[model samples]
Target: VSPKGARAASAGMFITLAAHVAAMAPGTNIGAAHPVSVGIAKMDKVMGDKVVNDMAAYARSLALERGRNADWAERAVRQSVSIHAAEAHRLKVVDLLAEDLPELLQKVHNLPVKLNKQTVILKTQGVPVHIMEEGLRTRILKHIADPNIAFILMLIGLAGLYFELAHPGVVLPGVVGALSLLLAFYAFQTLPVNFVGLLLIILAFVFFILEIYVTSYGLLTLGGVISLLMGSLMLYRTGDPGMAVAWSVLIPAVLIITLFFVGIGVLILHSQMRRSMSGVSGLIGERGEAYTDLNPEGKVFVHGEYWQAVSEEPVAKGEQVEVLKVEGLKIFVRKAS
Candidate 1:
């Protein structure tokens, strides 16, 4: 019988230990399933101890019900041990073996089963099997378990936020950033995330921002690139195969991010160095008509607006003049002679 909790709950220990006369398929196995927590704090240790103790007690109770060796069951729980089909049969943990589901069902038919102080009879002979598929949430979590998808979410989240910050008031960037962040969080929920590595990634972003303001001759940019690469490499460290981000994904992602930040930084610097394209600076060297005679100061028409102007040379009314400088609301001009 499969237990309520597969590996991470005390209930599983009790259920798995409850079979007085157990049988298994040819290649099946039974074991204790414990939670994996790395880099956890003192609270984690305390919780783990509590779970282990609870599981051991449950296993002992099941052993008592089955009239088997309770001490051995308790020991197994305490040690987080597992036994395969052959070993389990040798130790009297399982009573019989079958080659297929039909055979197993035939073996289980009319067997007396004890569950939570209730004695029941299982009628499994010739019964139709029903299989339930995973729900949407479970399916989504399974997809997020993939390292490539998780890494992609992280990259998109960072890029969207960067774009939103660089160009404020753009609603699209903010919306995309929020969506990407939500997806990243969903991915993180399933994957083992290292907070220190996350902190390093955040620090890299800070360096990239600082590079924009502080002229560090690419020093801050280089540091940011290194930090980002290291942080991505160390983001997840579970022993699960294919759970960690691939080097192929990491190298390309780092290159893209570095190029993005450097390109943005250069663009920002260029924008800073560029002259104003509006107001007085925009009018310099622009041709306008002298509305009145230019005796050092007169009214000139430019860009559909009349302005008080001063000229370097003598000019007649309606003569075209080029703007040389702007003093407050006034324009200084030279005749287009």
Candidate 2:
């Protein structure tokens, strides 16, 4: 029985019609059993027609077995027709109309039901209907199965792993990423995830990381953004809207993640391009005082240490010199102008 303000559409309609005693609350509506396609792959007209015809036949059979309106059931499958509870009862599409669960139980009580070729009357009167609660594991799984939540987890995992890889020894990001990624994968087991979308998302991250090493000039970043957007939009393959990511989450997530990865890539590139600060290369172009006079050879004090130096021109003692190049414990120098 449908609750108030609820609907029994698509597969719900089939379930309702197939019941021994179909029911609906006063504000509820039913019908609209047309099959919808949500996959990237499209069904041809012929195959589509066959599926629709098969469903229509099935709906008609259920209606006939329950002695309801077979024509309406067929129309619900073929034309996606729907009706309110009162109208459904008028059309003989439903066996009863109930205001609530208690009323429904009272109304369905003593109803004749055929079981194993034997007619059995329902004894719902004073029969406590125990509502089974979802187990903790199942509840958590269902929560994680949400497309947005799963997508967020996947991104967090990727970002964490990327951060850890970029800066090794940052143990927190790696641990978080690994855990989030594992959880996301587990959630994917329950969701209708498209492999193409998953691949695109992974490819996007690859591009983001490559942007740091390769001279793409933002081309890789742009590609990553496009891939991420497409991946987010096509993450879930389902006819049900509830199973897909919401736009509110997708838009901000894509922008934020893209910017974050791009920013990290830029920083890496900048740091790589910067000059060395603490090696022999750092000694080049340093000014120093001659420690001893020499005929094109002398000792110079540079960077707080004395080094053997040879100059193209003669340099006197106490004369300042500039280091040119370093070669095996010796430094080439020129007299300071």
Candidate 3:
């Protein structure tokens, strides 16, 4: 068992407990049941004591059941203790310690093992080894557990929802957003996500939307960006590098989203400030000549075409008029000074 890489908490503790005649290679490790590994290293005194006591009892019981060193197991849970393979074997925490598998098999050959009230002899003459192939579902689930993939899912979900909200009645964005959010949440179930961080991210989106209606200048947007960055930083503050959101993903994502939010807000604001150039708006400020007496309602030639023009004061034919507004096809105008 090369436990050389990292494994801890529930998976590590439970799997180690189930091992029979467990062996460890050099530079390998086992036995980590600390509650602090659950991302609450700074838990308060009373609660921390209770968690430690409970985990210690649980680990000790598992050790006793497996006929392993119960004292060391309790220490593993309470004090977050670890030891090298040589020490582990010397302490009988593991049955054997060897440099590699061949050495381990040779050392353990014919070693007596107690099997439920009977001693068993090892049959290690020439055991054929068949490696188990990873199933497709397991492989896919493994990939889904990646923090980078989860982060990408979150971004995709947010972008889709943003598009859907900005352009309502577009079914694609809403559908993609819903699915991506669900998948992201599924991934989050496996990840050590800080709820406050998740909430801050949501708040950032809220602020981004508020920039459109609330006239806080760009302050709300700046705050939103800050919230996003802080939220991302706290998203996986659990100390474990395996569970952390990558800085590479974080920086680029923040920049892209900041630009996206600001760009969208600017376009909308610009459109609102610019003169209307379509529909009834297109006729506003257009200069035209009255073709007939606008006894408040008559035809006027504007933009090289005739339009039904209306004015409060009477205007003579061939008089220059400026369009003030448009109601349906009727052009409201005033006589030019």
Candidate 4:
């Protein structure tokens, strides 16, 4: 049964036809039972025909058993045809049409349903309908089970981990990353995950990280992008659209994640290559004023503090000197030219 403005398409078509009394609400549509290929490799013409024929036969069998339109069922599977509620009733694709659930119940009250060993008549009239709501845990599991949600969670986990690794002191990112990864793994247990695709995604992250150390001139980043795209395409091994990540989700996710990894890598590399601004190394090449007269060694003020300084030549009092190097508590200096 399909609700108003809803459709019984693809796998839903098969289920609808198998019902003892198939039905559609006003403004609803049905048909389009074409089987989608979930294989990583493209099917050849002959193999494609075989799959279509097989699916068509199954659809035809279901329609015949339910005393529906077998020819329309076959056409639905083979040609991906669809029909509105009124047209479906005219074509015998559906047994009845109703405005709502109550009307449907009223219509199917005395409808005959064939059983394995007997014929049964429905007693739906005046049957009070009680809708059961999903529990919190069930709702959470349902959201998590979605391929798009799982994929996003996995990406978030990777991004968090990447941030944590790049800057180790950040505790929040690591914690978030670990939790997201756990959830993603839990989802994977129920999802149809392709291990090869998983490996490719991991490899993509590796490539992005390598960009920071190895100077590949964007080659590594490009490879990472390619790997990510391919992995996204092959992630879920299922023909069901609900089980697969939508292209809308995939495109944005890939672009955003790729930029994120590469951007982080660039920031890290820049920080590593930049000159130090603190400690002894920072004092080198700094000019300081002589605080005391120096025959060969004296005190000099540098970076707002006094330091022991040594000069190869004699320097007078109140002279400015340039620090060349720092060793322990002493700084090698030369008179400012």
Give TM per candidate.
0.63, 0.76, 0.78, 0.75
- lDDT by residue (tens digit), candidate 4, 97-145: 8888888898889888889979999998788899999999999999987
Better of 2 and 4 by lDDT: 2
| Ten contiguous residues minimizing lDDT sum, candidate 1 | 1-10
- The lDDT ranking, best first, is 2, 4, 3, 1
Q: After superposition, how far is residue 177 of candidate 3 from its true place, in Å?
A: 1.4
Clashing pairs in 2: none
Q: Give the TM-score of candidate 4.
A: 0.75
Q: Worst ten-residue run, lDDT, model 2?
A: 35-44
What shift in Å separates residue 337 of candidate 2 from its native position after superposition?
9.4
lDDT of 2: 0.88
Full-model lDDT for every candidate: 0.74, 0.88, 0.79, 0.86
Candidate 2 residue-wise lDDT at 201: 93
Writing each residue's lDDT as its tens digit, candidate 2 over 1-337 gives 5567899988899999998888888888898787765433456789989999999999999999989999999999998898999999999999988888899899888889987679999999998789999999999988887778999999999999988998899899999999999989988876667778988999999999998889999999999999999988878876543668899999999999988987787778788888776679988988999999957887999999999999989999999999889998999999988
Mind giving the per-residue lDDT tens digits that candidate 1 earns over 70-149?
77677776765666666766776656766665777888799887777898998987789997999999898787757677
What RMSD value applies to candidate 3? 4.3
